[model samples]
Target: MLVPLVIGMSAPSGLEGGELAAVVARGELVWAADQEGGGPHVFPDPDAPQRLTGFEVELAELIAAELGVKARFQQGQWDRLPLLLGHPADCVINGIELLPERRRDYHCSRPYFAYGLQLIARRDGPLDTVETLTAPGPAGRWRVGVLTGSAAELFLRSHPELEVDAIGYDGTIDSLEQVKSGVLDAALMDDCIFNFYADRFAGLRAVGRPFGGGYYTVLTARDTPRLSTAIDEALGRIIADGRLKTLYDRWDLGGRQQILALRDAAEIPVATRRSLRELAIETLPLLLSAAGMTVLLACLSFPLAIFAGLGVALGRLYGPAWLRPLLTGFVEVVRGTPLMLQLYAIFFLLPKVGLALPALVAAVAGLALNYAAYESEIYRAGLKAVPLGQFEAAVALGMTKWQALRHVVVPQAVRLVMPPVTNDFIALFKDTSVCSVITVIELTKRYSVLALSTGRIVELAVITAILYLAMSWPLSLLSRRFETGQEQRP
Candidate 1:
């Protein structure tokens, strides 16, 4: 989802030091946001699918114009924005709140917007207020959904006595949909977001006073102090020129943002200090839990792929004439389409027909089916590489046709196939990260969540990369051992 700037029009400036200057030099100020968060902050414009239009989008544009550069937008998962800074984007402006920990990790601009949490519930639902369902009875049982890494979740998590069964999701629309459909008792998110959906969903209504939120600031990397300063100054000018207020009015972010912008109340959050060893010790357990899922994905699906692939390969090569073409078509179809589409089909699309599967089952099934196509090719090559004389020799020795293949050809072909098989197996380890789309919390997804939740993107990513290496290295060693043993075989 990292949409890079593709406009061919280039303008080059020769300035130095700051990210702002660098962006100006390149003729584009690349801003990153995750559209999944949705609504008045940043989402795709319905009338124009390819364009983004929100207060934050407009805010980025004004600042870019202030620095005399074009605004380029890139999309990354919301939890991964901090990681994308300085890599794919010069800064991020997706209504990132002015949290204490965020200020510590990133070179954040002064607050441009201020808002609070809005508790949203079904209009006809029994829950009317936060205190309404807090009574001591069966009716007090409430299942609330919150965006996984938001302050709403943090607030709810701090109060276990509330006995709220909290559900975490990555997007706003899903939680709202769940609330509307009675799947969730209520949903909590930003007031600005609630405003975007207020008129759109007649069944959903925002209730209770908006509470417990702070200013939203733009984030740049800590290394880019010069760029940070430029952002601060540009934002100041935008406020003074009334452009900031115009955006707030246009986007319905309430008049409170204008007051906060004019008042300029920005405090840097204190940074946490820890040794490398301390950091590693803190993060390893969480990473390890996620790594276990990744390993499970590879381990569960791979042998199935091997067995299915070998069967298909044999059928294609030596089955009845009518079956050969069918097996060949199966290989072509599976290989031709993307693995992502296959996952969506199994997990998202199939449920319409009542074949609903759990996330893990869908992920394993999708991976097995996808890999079987490639594995069949590897197997077919190995089968063909077996000299015909070997089969002839076995058949001449009173072995049945199936017996010759099972005992002689397959055993030899498997040896030749082992090296590539092991290599694919290792590659499949990393590929399991994509299973996050199906809600399987593999290593990479865990890293994103932990990184955002704890504001330790760099530390978590280093540990995660090591975990991935740890998963694949053993397979590499095993493959090398097989290769050496194969070479030593005669």
Candidate 2:
């Protein structure tokens, strides 16, 4: 019997368990991303509760049914889904495009659906067609908003004079709203998505025709060859037997047929395929460049965190009774919440409250604030670890409370906290990847951009990991040395 496998569902309309009955019988399981409210590629219909109804869901259900497995659903962020592939889910069934770079890390199922890049403009805008929008003049130079890390943004970036105002939104609907509110002149998005929202907004319209034919494929982990083959065959069968066509008709995706045909012929051209040596050489500079940014961010943020943590620790340990509670609550709140959400709040929400900050500055501030909260706890523990007799002895020697803390308490506390601080620094370095969501091109962000460009996520991610290890190993060694020296001095 086949081992039970989990397949991811991208949206509610795409696929579901009813189609995966065959796969369930064979001991396979279908797991769908809980995109209840819609994300970048998936949109939730208000009519449905905690379920999606897109092309991704329908196709995934069909695949699971064919494999005779039961289908299950779970929710995860779009960016986080890649990390979840081998763990919580066997394959991500979103309408993922099969790009050359992506093939390095994932095995993509045959193309089952297609969409194209389209321009969305406000109803009151003078620009309505692609020709008029791109025509040579100031009026034609409208700012086009796109989601960061998406193909649309990358494509726009390649054009120097396009006046792109790329925004990194957690969801496509949010990006669309920016355009609707006139915060952005226009938005470049998938045609299918534009159609879904255009009806509701009334002010938005798809400009010109769709371009850059894109197709959807199931993304499986690279190591799962057998599973990959099974998926491809199942998809091929669906297409050959006309079930795929019927599903598309039912979903009104017939307009995407030409793009699907183009996707069927897709493959990485030989000229673009680099050998291992070439790939390494090409990726080295990028990795190095991003590493420098990561180091810079960490260096700038660490000192701030340490200082803030020290202040918070002192306040909690020695402040007036009323103030102590406030400081303690502040530290606890920051520590309890996710660092990513905090960063998002700072980058996206803060600007609206008239506290705008540059992306890099916001990232550094968020990282520093997050680490400071944890570090305060660490410092407080370190402070307590110092014996009370030491302070008493300082007092006997005629030292004041402030002097005792500065001279006697702090030195010992530093030694006690040094190891944990070093460990925290290493973690902070890795956590810096979250800043990429706000457009800070740190080490991980650079790798992700390269991965999207080359479609080689596994190799690139591995290389990035190794680089991180190399950078952090020395810090680990230094922490050990500090511990040894502290022991010898005492």
Candidate 3:
């Protein structure tokens, strides 16, 4: 889930020479955050999508000014924001909960924003409180949604006795929408986020007093201790001067939970790291399950893409001339766009027109459509490569044009394209990672979550890569066998 970004950025102003001196030289504090679907933390202004606004935005600016530098925002996925530290980002100012696991991996500043888990339910729903939710329910368990890789998810999963199904969504607002539509019985998110978005989602009400308190802390690379110290001091100054409170009040984040921000830095608990063997033992099953998802997504989509692409290829080559332009245009459009955008459109945009697809279905459909464009090109080439003699020979045997295509040309084309088609299947396995943005938890997303929580990036990543190889190796060998067979055949 960690996207590549350039590194070698300087740290903040307080540091003298070495890597820490870059911020003073550039006079910019490059902070990483995810503005997309990141409400109340950092999100685009509704009036002007290009402009970013949020309490965290102001907090970043405040810290930047305190460091005597300008703040520049770097956009990244929320779950992968920490990975930007020390590279493209001087620090991360998104709502990164100061969990013990994250603190164990990265340098964490003192708390700047206090928060807690807030449960949201339909205003007229029978479930009234967390206590009520914990009580024995009907035959079906209540489906409660939380943002994937969020502290809310951790808190919810920690208590199996709660007896609710914890569904993960890519965004807090997405979960709220599910609640509003009755797709979910309830949702849990940061209290600050709930406060910020409450008016936007009118049908939902807070189900109980906020629980499972935590604080949002700034994170920097472990090597940037000076920058981390400066950030901590800046946060302390912001809190002591009442500026933090004023910012919170402006954002409606002022509440009793805000007191959590006042704890001494030493009060933060130190997290213990587990050995790699222990971590592997614990996470292997989850990774295997996620790998199963990766396999399922690719297996389900590639066949569909193959069939659809073949149909498109045939239509362009042999069907009505009028249909050719439309099919060609489809190939152009789908090939021109990113698969992520296609999935986003299917999962998010389609919901507006009353065509909301379940996450897995949307993911499969998006991957199928996106790859079908490339598959069409491959098939088109394969069909074109067939010699004119093949069609003529079939026609000389009294076969119709359709019969000639079905009996002779297309089969040869499929054989010609089989290797490339298998190659695409391998590629589609990797592309399944993009489906994570739609809340489809596959291998890569699972690796990211486990790596973040367990601080075992390389170990989990190697396992994930091996799982991918294991899945694709058989196909690769099959493709080679087919190549050898064709080479031997005439």
Candidate 1 residues lying further than 4 Å off, grouped into runs, are 1-28, 117-188, 194-212, 240-242, 256-268, 318-326, 386-412, 452-459
Q: TM-scores across all candidates?
A: 0.78, 0.73, 0.90
Give each model's whole-structure lDDT. 0.79, 0.71, 0.84
Tens digits of per-residue lDDT for model 2, 339-441 = 9899978876775566767678998999999999999999999989999999999989999988899899988998889988999998898898888766577
lDDT of 1: 0.79
Question: What lDDT tens digits, residue by residue, belong to model 1 across residues 1-490?
Answer: 1112111101121223655667778999889998878888788899997887777888889998988898998998776677667776788998787776786677778888777888899898877787764564355568787876677877787777775866666788767866765656788888888888877778998888888777778898777777878888999899877777777777666555566544866565666856678767877887898899999999999999999999999989888999999989989999999887788678766765667676789999999988998999999999999999999999999999889999999999999999999999998888887787655778887777776766655656667877888889999999999999999998
Candidate 2 weakest lDDT stretch, 10 residues:
1-10
Candidate ranking under lDDT, highest first, comes to: 3, 1, 2
Residues forming the 10-long window of minimal summed lDDT in candidate 3: 4-13
The per-residue C-alpha lDDT of model 2 at residue 343 equals 92
Steric collisions counted per model? 0, 37, 0
Put the candidates in TM-score order, highest first: 3, 1, 2
Model 3, span 1-490: residue lDDT tens: 3322112223332333344567867899999988864778899998999999998899999999998999999998777777677677889998888888888898888877777799999998888879977776554788888887788889888998887887777778878877786667899888878878888989899988989877788998877777778888998898878788788777777633474445533467779999888998999999999999999999999999999999999999998999999999999999998999899889877877778787899999999999999999999999999999999999999999999999999999999998888888888988999998877889888888887788777667778778888998998998898888889989
